[model samples]
Target chain A: MNFDKELDARGMNCPLPILKTKKSLTDMVSGQVLKVISTDCGSVKDMQAFADQTGNTLVSQTEENGEYIFFMQKK
Target chain B: MKKMAIIATKGTLDMAYPPFILASTAAALGYEVQVFFTFYGLQLLRKDLSSVMISPLANPAMPMPVPMPVMVQMLPGMESMATMMMKQKLKKHGVASLQELRDLCLEAEVKFVACQMTVDLFEFDKSEFIDNIEYGGAATFLGFAGDTDICLFV
Candidate 1:
């Protein structure tokens, strides 16, 4: 799916992936999608928690080749 | 978003990290987070602060990735060496630097409370900290923590 912004947090750890996603989401209008790619296993839980708390939508997420891909929509 | 309050009490590298990490994450999660620094924690608020020291004397939690005798940790220069190793490990894991964590906390609007009593007792130069840090006593911090879902002392 197409996204409004893409953040490559490939090597970053838990908090960075989520924190960067949040910083990006702030400028996004409601309904805009953000694509985040991360290698850190902990990002999965962190992003999920972040989305759940911040009222953002964790539209979809999948992992391939050890990299977790998350598509979140700004709420 | 509800409120979260963290009391940071130590200046060591290991001790300083928990508040920064937890408070920043809480703020990012849409919570109003407040971190109150008292005692040794005031060092982290200094404007020219560098990396913190590791208290190896009794820190069993300190990771020695390579197998080493516990007594070896007490050798001269070992504390600094351990601190340096910790910094490198943190870097290798892509963990944000201490300074970056602090900046992120502030950017997320995490309220930073500096204890006025400690400030006066230690004679800390008030000019050493960045602006936007609120100076308060126990009453003020407890006021913010009054109804928070999470209240932590780190």
Candidate 2:
């Protein structure tokens, strides 16, 4: 997936990963894709909910080993 | 925006984290968050929390990687050590400090309401806090809480 920025939220727990993602996405241009890698199992649900809440589009998501990879296109 | 109200009632370090963390998270989730700081909770909005310490004596469930007994936690200097350890852990996790969290709340447009009665009772000066705060009484906070779909006392 093409991404304008990357956020490595591995090892971070709930809220931290999402908060960091929110902060990073705030600085990016609209319609840019943010690639997020998180180890928190909850990130699967958290990112989807976050994307919906913020009006961002979840372009793609996949899991490799334990890491949750998500591609979000900012609205 | 959906609204969320939080009641913060403790001043200890362990007690201080939840309100901000949850408030910021709710804000990120597209909720218009409001935090009512009353009684000891006022310390969370204090101008300087650099001296805040966790009450290890009261929190038995604290996630101390190595659990310590009550007597050991009661020893002199243990509380400060624990507070430092917790702060370090938060920093290591890339979590924002209290001041930064407060700024995030402001950035998120989270409404911070200071309890008027508590301030009057404690004889605290109003000027001792950061700017952009709103002052209100129990009724004011209750009115907001009543209107909010998600409200809790943290």
Candidate 3:
């Protein structure tokens, strides 16, 4: 299924990017995906912890040209 | 997917803890959190003033039940004590300082907005704040708040 949204959280800091992603995900339907692009290095760990804590699915993640991209499915 | 906005305006010793703690905890809990600093809250972004921003004896918001004058006498050094206590509590709980939190937000990609009106009012140049802070107006903040699920005036 097509992801519901793309969130560009690049250049933001820890909790703000995660917070924005969380905010985006809340409005998403179950099973829908959100693509989060961030420049923050800590988002990798933070989002992992977030997915674990919230029961959301971290579908995929990768780094390209210095940006961190993550795909998450709403629980 | 819950979105929350916290407006941080007070920068007193007692006032600082709640916003940071609540915002960080909210982020930890998987909720999206945004903090908008305005007025005295902007002091938090000031490296020099941040550490010195304390409640004076005249502050009505001090927790003492006594009159302001008496409270000052009754609680000499309380601001420093409170600061120490907050630092200890944060360390014990693994919470970061305002500066560290700012770094963590940068690392975590958290969004931070500083009110432009306050900046102008205080004659603060953008360089006075940490790098990467987005400058915005009330309309911008309201736009974000409008779309968010929760909003708080702290």
Candidate 3 residue runs with Cα over 4 Å from true position:
A1-53, A56-75, B48-52, B56-95
Candidate 2 — which pairs collide?
A: none
> Per-residue lDDT for B13-119 in model 3, tens only?
55765677566656656567788989988876665544644554455554543445744544768767656765665556444456665554454445668999999
Report the CAPRI category for model 2: medium
Residue ranges of candidate 2 with Cα displaced over 4 Å: A10-12, A27-30, A64-67, B65-67
| Candidate 1 wrongly placed segments (more than 4 Å) | B66-72
Which of 1 and 2 is the better model by lDDT?
1
TM-score of chain A of 3: 0.95
The lDDT, on a scale of 0 to 1, for candidate 2 is 0.86
Kindly list the per-residue Cα lDDT of model 1 for residues A1-75, writing each as its tens digit.
999999999989867888889889889899999999999999888888888788899999999999999999999
Candidate 1 CAPRI level: high
Q: Write the per-residue lDDT of candidate 3 for residues A4-73, one digit (tens) a residue.
A: 8999987676466776787788778999999999888888998888898889999998999999999999
The residue-by-residue lDDT of candidate 1 on B6-86, one tens digit each, is 999999887888999898888888889999999999988987656478856677666677766768877898878888888
By summed lDDT, the worst window of 10 consecutive residues in model 1 chain B runs over B48-57
